[model samples]
Target: MLRLPTFQLHEPASLKEACALFAEHGAAAKILAGGTDLLPNLKHEIYDVDHVISLAKLPGITGFEMQGHDLVIGALTPLAQVATNPNIQKHAPALAQAASLVAGPQHRQMGTLGGNVMLDTRCQWINQSYFWREALGFCLKKDGTVCHVVEGGKKCVAAASNDTAPALMTLGASLTFVSATGTREIPIEDLWVADGINNKSARPGEILTEIRLPLRDHTHHGAYGKLRERGSIDFPLLGCAVRIDLDDADCVRDAAVSLVALQARPLLIKGVDALLQGLKLGSTELDQAIEAVAQLAHKKCKPLDNIPGDKDYRRRMVPVYVRRTLRAALDGTGPVHHI
Candidate 1:
């Protein structure tokens, strides 16, 4: 059995104390949230840190509320709540669908929304037992220089496998960060850099405080589709999210498509507005636009052989999932997932 590395666990009573502890520990400290991802990584010896700052004592970061035109969610809110919350279902069904599809009931009960957002990039080569990785001489993500996914590759390409990221991106979300220094909020797009070795832009002493999602006055429809090996307890081989806003006449006003499990960052498919704009629901024009968007996604998304599934197969399923998700959005039937 894999064993977690030795570490000093620090549970702070408040954010002030937590930030101070982080500031003191610097690079040697790692934040512990739900322990869904972090603990497993620790067992695999992915991170060797001296201190683990637990947020269990921190308060006021575990619920959902509406602040003006935005749906503000506490970072520590359970995934089960996010999946079943009535407000989230009304305003951001795609996100709810994504949350519901995460792992299983027990995992959802333990996993937090913020934990899902901050999930690490995953790769088949690196996410293994120490002995298995040692036998293969490791890869770029961990203690090795070589990248097995690509021949002589210089950068790590571990795919981002978070289900909620694409859904939140399509919902036009932003995140708030707090530290001993102060607090700052940024669009979710800014949270990620392209490098898989260390993808987040969050600073060492910062704690993700909350997530904000904008609410529009227009009619909205959304869906999430995941391609995976099993219905539960499996991450996506390909994950797609679709969002389309309509006017009173049921014509498209704005649209977006975002995907994960493709690369180091969740991909926001480009030129979606150009194809989907002004198309009426239930019309041939809308159907044609959906097809065009799927084709466009297929052309833009290139899956590397970093995750468990066949990369080429994953590539082919991108359009298929995207198309199905878009259709489900229009039909008011959601989260087009395999069960």
Candidate 2:
């Protein structure tokens, strides 16, 4: 059996206390939200962490509310709740669909949205038993310098497997972070950098406390599509999220598309608005435009052999999922997946 390394655990009663503990521990400390992700990495000795600061008791980080045109969600809110919340489902259907498809019932019950947002990039070579990785001389993501996915590669290319990130990006979400120093907010799209070894930009000791999404106008329709090895309990091989805003006459006014599980960060396809704008659903032009946008997404996204599935196969499926997800958004029938 794989055993976790010994570590000091700190349960901070307040968000302030949690930030303080993190500040004190610095790089030696890791934050514990749901433990669905962090605990497995801990058992694998991924970080050599010496301290774990738990946010279980941290106040003001576990609820949802609406303030004017914003849907404010506490970072600690469970994925299960995010999936089923009426407010989220109605206002941000893509996010709700993405949350519902994460892992399985048990994982969703425990994993928090913040944990998913802060999910570490994953690679086939790195997320293995210590002995397995050690025998293979380790990869660049952890102990060694070599990158298995790219020959003589200088940097890691671990895939970002978060389902909610792309959906959040499509909805124009923002995140609030707190630290001993102060509090700051940034657009969800700005939270990620291209580096796969550690994909997030949240400074060390900064705690993500809240997620805020703008109230989408009634003209907005969205969906999330996932490609995985199974119907549930598996990370996506490829994930697509789409948003289509329609005019009063049911013609596309604007559109956005984002794809994940490809590289270090989720990809937001550009020029989608130009392609789909002013096209009414059920028209030949709209159909052709969706195909065109999918082709554009395929061109921009290049899958590597960093995660599960053949990179070529995953790359080929990009346009398929993107087209289907966009169709689902237009039909208000999201979360396209193979059961």
Model 2 CA lDDT for position 90: 89
Shift in Å, residue 289, candidate 1: 0.7
Note the Cα lDDT for every prediction shown: 0.92, 0.94
For residues 292-328, could you state the per-residue lDDT of candidate 1 as single tens digits? Answer: 9999999999999989899899999999999999999
Residue 84 lDDT (model 1) = 96
- Which 10-residue window in model 1 sums to the lowest lDDT? 214-223
Cα RMSD, each candidate:
0.9, 0.7
How many residue-pair clashes does candidate 2 contain? 0
lDDT of 1: 0.92
Count clashes in each candidate, considering only residues at least 3 apart in sequence or on different chains: 0, 0
Best-fitting candidate, measured by lDDT?
A: 2
Q: Which regions of candidate 2 deviate over 4 angstroms?
A: none
lDDT of 1 at 259: 99
